[model samples]
Target: MKKITLLSLLAAFVISCADKSQAPGAAPVPLLPVATVTNENTITDSEYPASIQGKVDVEIRPQVSGNLDRVLVDEGAYVSKGQTLFKINERPFREQLNNALASLHGAEAALINAQLEVDKLTPLVQNKVVSDYQLKLAKSSYRIAASNIEQSKAMVASAKINLGYTNVTAPVSGYIGRLPKKQGSLVSASDMEPLTTLSDVHEVVAYFSLSETDFINFKSHYAGKTIGDKINHLPPVSLILADNNAYPQKGKIDMVDGQFDKTTGAITLRATFPNANGTLRSGNTGKIRLGINHDNAILVPQSATVEMQDKIFVFTLNKENKVSKMPITVIGKSGVNYLISEGVKSGDQIVLSGIDKLQEGQLIQPEKSAPKVAQIINKK
Candidate 1:
């Protein structure tokens, strides 16, 4: 009876195993949202940290030593070229000028006397009353007097220049910076600091740098053998101001450094922008936006990528609808997309959703998807 009961229990366990195998819930294929890769022209934009400066920058310093008698223009004023911005005490310069003039007048009187002596002796020598040697000595005296008058004239011209220096004027049209010296402050040519600075902001320049590798890559994209030709072919760039707003006018790359900086291993680049509204100034910080046009390029949504062990990968669906984790090389980043340089080609489909649940060689149900990738990338 015990043997019969044991046989019946064994039969029941076998039936249970058979039932489980015949059931419909073995392993489920996960349904995933996917995006189809397409070939298209994409203009990828990149931004670099930049410092802005006015086209012209001038330091306002005293050309001659003097007390600042009057501040003709206040700080932060818009000054035109040759406009008097500061007035030094003219009394001292005027007195020096008068002294120079007096010396010149005395030299001129001496010259007149010398000329009178020469004129008086010329006829006497002609008539043989005075010897030719004596007449020659009188003419020589007159020439010496004329030379003295020339030296005095030079002194007068120098004094005039010095007097003109008392009235400090703007060297170029621009906005004035801080004024270190007020009306009572004394300034001189040898002072370590400048009185003020002027910046011409009719146009502005943005300076930026690129790493050696990046510079090489940057030059490779443009069509040219020489750097000048490359620069000429370069398209216009854009500037983002400090306030995070795009400037109204587009700028061009005006200059490129001939060599890389030894210390930084980076090359400098400059772009110029028109400042019609006087918004940009020297010492302003901003960003320079450079663009590259890719023809028939393959782009992948960043959401489709998975990072593991310091590498990037995406799950590509095969003809059988089975997923295989494929590696990809990202050369650049755009708004929510990776500018794929290697690993994946055009027309490849990649999983865009349910990446966490994905596994190597996993079978999945793919759904056509257009994710909010750009929206997500921009927010980040």
Candidate 2:
């Protein structure tokens, strides 16, 4: 209690001295640290959540119905194009092929018999031993037998194709994903679940979406008027892995979706990154970082600015050294500074400290100092 009273009396004595001094001249000036507005190139970064995938993501499905006899490739194995991955039971297919071959042989034999009959009737007709009508019947029979043989040949070809399908080969060069079906599992052509998945991860693509407003802003920041020029001139992007570690390799934005999705109101973009070490894979979640550079950008230390009722303000000293709070338009931020678009120009003097106690048009002592925003909390 005594300390509080003593402090209040000291404050009153200081106020009395200030009032007497002001009565003679003006008011007591508040000492403030100031920094000059700087203009330089600044880069702003934006991060969007992204999903990573390989260049080719394919579901391994069976083309023929059969019991899985062998799984040649283990899960997550690297496979070359046309490499055998699975083998289904070929016994059933081979039996069907034998049946088709037998039918085809029977038809061929019938065709031979019909041809003999036609030959016999042809000579008989010439000798007048059989009627010409009988010869015509024999010729028709021969044509029917030929048609039957052709039909049976088609069946044999189809069976052969099915038998070949028993050995499933990798259609592309990639790494195998999860193996859902085990050996001896009855897999069919119409099965709901795929046998496995294959992903070519040599180069991975990170897909991210941009909101319509963000997309427009991004396009406007580039140097070109056309979309192609903007894309071609775009800077490389970086990837943040799921664990928040930065990916070692940088990526380039090469593809954009045709249009915005109606339901999501966002446009998709793809960035390709090299996975030479085969670290990236399909279905990985990450973030994509995009950088935008601004030339001759005006930057203000955040400590020099004050926010009042959601508007940002900074105290500028006029020629008379009187401080006046002025509003500044903050377009973006880089580290500890706000990139002001308007309301503050280059070479303006801004107060860096004691902002909470400042009033508009207050006369004060201006001290030129280079105090960073991060160091303000440690100031005396």
Candidate 3:
């Protein structure tokens, strides 16, 4: 009987221990990855893809018909106002000028002969040596000769002006482009073919088109601010290129179109930027950034937020340390963090990892880890 009783007690002890292991009790809650709430009235700059252009681009064309003799400037050479850029063969122009001069000299000689005849006839008429009709005829001939001299003088002037066209000079101070009509090629004044191109690059203009909705929004936001106010009073503008590299110099809003494009429902705007170093070139792509204001807000890493069917959600830890789904309103994305316009507030512990295995009210062994500092700071 004693041996049987001892065996029963040992069996009962084992069963009790097994039952105790399966009993409902407190479990260690695994520390979850979380971020602290930061209050920032951050000014987020809006960036858009833009293009850089010159204030004025001029196509260089020959003014008179001739063969191109020499292109004095190389491709991409900076030229100054009145600087000689090309030299055409002046031999033909010189010959034409010589012909005009000869015509002028002949006209002067005829005028002198007519005047001598008029003077002699006037004395003869006064002394009754010549008839009045003869004197009148000499006067008429002198007047006609005088008119001829004036016409010849005009012709000579025009010829000299045309000859001056042989030396092509830059009309403006700018950078010159490649010679479209190379040396030894024939060019004309009537043709539209450009001999070369010149553009002022000390400062550049950026042209961009915005839709009506965007235009209205911009005007509504900045109704009372001047461009200088926008530059100094607001956030600084930044430029980005097609290669995705950010341009160092900042730009300002130069102008906005007066009329909206009806067909496209858009309005064109232009911005000017200093290009003293010629780094901001014409015909290059760029982007602009403008600042907008938002009030106190909560920000969270974009990775911590999940979207489903157009709804954004974030995992939150409850009092029992259980993962719960919470909806959030994303105001804007500042770099890598999403500014929560609503829904999430300060002092909320959020789950940053192991979101895949999480369920609402499900107990978890939350392993406490530091919030992503680098990830948050990178949003700046």
Candidate 4:
């Protein structure tokens, strides 16, 4: 009985040893999608909040103080240069002009009388009918009368200018704004509020700002010796209206603020767009879309990257299919891919999935596939 039990135990031990030796050599290395990094040309858009203004924005105000007698143009009406926009009470101005004319006539009559006296005295003095002192005094009186006539003429001209001011005219071709003062309302040159505002919308300007860092990046992308040169070389930009619709006409960057705002630490830029149809107006809000082109740029899918400790990393495979976690410097984003400036270069293989389960130096079965190159043109 003891010998049979020993045989059974020996058979069990042999089976256990065979099972241990046959165990799966090791869990098959995880298989994950792999993509090759490639260099391609693409354009990415960056948007900045902007404020729109007309090419010529002017405040319409009264030059002369008087009661508003008529408002000729309605609010939001288009006007041309020299068109009459409003009429102040002209009766008072006309009366002042008449008074000036009467004074001028009176002065003219006095000048004629003075001239007659000077003529009479000149002959008398030459004939010895009066002393030379009397002639000199008459000549002085004539000079004073002539001076008075000149002064009266100046007064008449001044009155005419004031009368002309009664009819307020448009200074430029533009659209009229609100008419705060109605007919019969008193308006003056010193009034706190302007009568209205005029905006020449034949073309519109959009003003946007960029932070200090963004400005530096923007400068690096373009090739120019000066800001003005950069502006001239810059490609046309697009305007996105408040409703998120792109403005039909593209705009050009024409101006850059001379200095950064001390408070905001940002620099302002101006882009001008043609508004032949008057689609854009003053006080309109929008965004400026600036496109940056990249040539031979290395792009990587965002999904293949993992962010740790505020740094982005990717799993790159070596010749032996061993993956090593590598850090990449991202310059910008295009659709679902990232624009890589540093790190892995062209022909580099990167693991596309299951990155969370990957260790620093893990073996991966790279299921080779084409990398996703984002849409060539992307807007943000």
Highest TM-score scorer:
1
For model 4, the superposed segments whose C-alpha errors exceed 4 Å read 1-34, 41-43, 293-296, 303-315, 320-326, 351-380
TM-score of each: 0.87, 0.77, 0.78, 0.81
Q: For residues 1-380, what per-residue lDDT tens digits would candidate 4 score against the true structure?
A: 99999999999999999999988787788888887777888776789999999999999889899999999999999999999999999899899999999999998898898888889899889999899998888888889888998999999999999999999999999999998999999999999999999999999999999999989988888889999888888999999998899999999999999999999999999999999998888999999999888899888878889999999999999999899999999988766778899989988888877998899888888775544333322322
Once superposed on the true structure, which residue ranges of model 2 sit more than 4 Å away at CA?
1-35, 38-42, 123-129, 223-226, 293-295, 301-327, 334-337, 351-380
RMSD of each: 4.5, 7.8, 4.6, 4.7
Q: Which ten residues in a row have the lowest lDDT in candidate 3?
A: 227-236
Q: Give the TM-score (vs. native) of candidate 3.
A: 0.78
lDDT by residue (tens digit), candidate 1, 109-147? 989999999999989988999799988898898898899
> Following a full C-alpha superposition, what root-mean-square deviation does model 4 have from the true structure?
4.7
Winner on TM-score (1 vs 4): 1
Give lDDT for model 2: 0.88
Sorted on lDDT, best first, the list reads 4, 2, 1, 3
Which ranges in model 1 have alpha carbons more than 4 Å from their true place? Answer: 1-31, 243-245, 368-380
Q: Between the candidate structures 2 and 3, which one is better when assessed by lDDT?
A: 2
In model 4, how large is the Cα lDDT of residue 317?
91
lDDT of 3 by residue, 289-374 (tens): 66566566577777787888899888887677677798898866766777787776777767766676666787765455555433
